[model samples]
Target: MKGDVIFGKKGKLSPMFIGPFEILEKIGTLAYRVALPPMLAGVRNVFHISMMRKYTSNLSNVLNYEPLQLTPNMSYEERPTEILGRQEKKLRNKVIQIVKVKWLNHLEEEATWKTDKDMRTRYSALFDKY
Candidate 1:
């Protein structure tokens, strides 16, 4: 549809969808031109149908989305929000400590396991509470 919203990109540790941009016009049988915000001026406005997914609006599914301050390269850094849990992986020689990390702009179920040592060295403040 012309006014439908769609998923932009599947970025790592970022929101699955970006905007509810209006469809400007249909380019061909398989492509459509999108009305993109000024912040995404550098991005290509036309997209194929296969790359888009219709966004369904639900009051309960609404989220408070904070726009990221992207660098010149159209990228932003992802930071850890908290340490959820910890576990140890035993290898043949040594044991590796891993921590479940919840990152900003992500849900609890999306949390990932990362090396405790590397996370501590990079983001030591997250470990202060524990």
Candidate 2:
């Protein structure tokens, strides 16, 4: 398949992007055209799809993607600490306390182990042996 990609001539293989790049270019021009707003073509979805494809990759769903070190306690900086200390809080808060104690343990989830393990795993500079 890759040989088809590499060795094939410019027009030999199917267009890899299937002309979204052309549409994206048009959207850019339309964004600048305040004189005509509806020329945008109900294209918010198109813009969202383009941005998502640009910023994120299939790697985001893979387990092999490098883990990020997030300070679970200080991680939710937007939330107040009082939320953690609230006694009347439900079991979730108790769970948060346990997570704070274990640092990255906050990511722990049952049934779905991959996300939790990926979050807690200490990633190294070295590549995976696999």
Candidate 3:
């Protein structure tokens, strides 16, 4: 439930905000039934007041903004754009490989360190140059 996220972490550092969404009605004292995009149709739209934030006029404040693109199951794919760096971590006798990945539409500071195996499977093209 990514309710009106402006500046926060999303499974590493994907900043997203989906609002200016209208309040459909007040569900109770602390909750409001807000109108959400059709992509979020499968989930409940009612949110606690704490989840919502006051509106801001400056659009660029939405850091590395990327519009929510939902799939049939109401899930969005977060694609990594590039392999920024790599490292190897030693765990007992085994070595684990990790890569710093820059997600598409995300800023450099938001780039996340992910498992190299995971990146290879999900974004094989990121390694085509290597």
TM-score of each: 0.55, 0.14, 0.47
* Pairs of colliding residues, candidate 3: none
Task: Give Cα-based local distance difference scores for all models.
Answer: 0.86, 0.31, 0.80
Model 2 regions more than 4 Å off: 1-24, 32-43, 47-100, 105-130
Error of 1 at 5 (Å): 22
Q: In candidate 2, what are the lDDT values of residues 1-130, reduced to their tens digit? A: 5445421234457454321233323345323211213333443434434333342446555554345455765353222111111112237445321112122323323212112223235332111311
Candidate number with the higher lDDT (2 or 3): 3
Better of 1 and 3 by lDDT: 1
Which TM-score value belongs to model 2? 0.14
Off by over 4 Å in 1: 1-64
Better of 2 and 3 by TM-score: 3
- Model 2 residue 119 CA deviation (Å) reads 20
Off by over 4 Å in 3: 1-64, 72-74
**Model 3 lDDT tens row, 1-130:** 5544333345534554557789999986999998887766775888899888889678676655567778898777778888899999899999999999998767899999999998899788879989
lDDT of 1 by residue, 59-83 (tens): 9877788788788999888999999
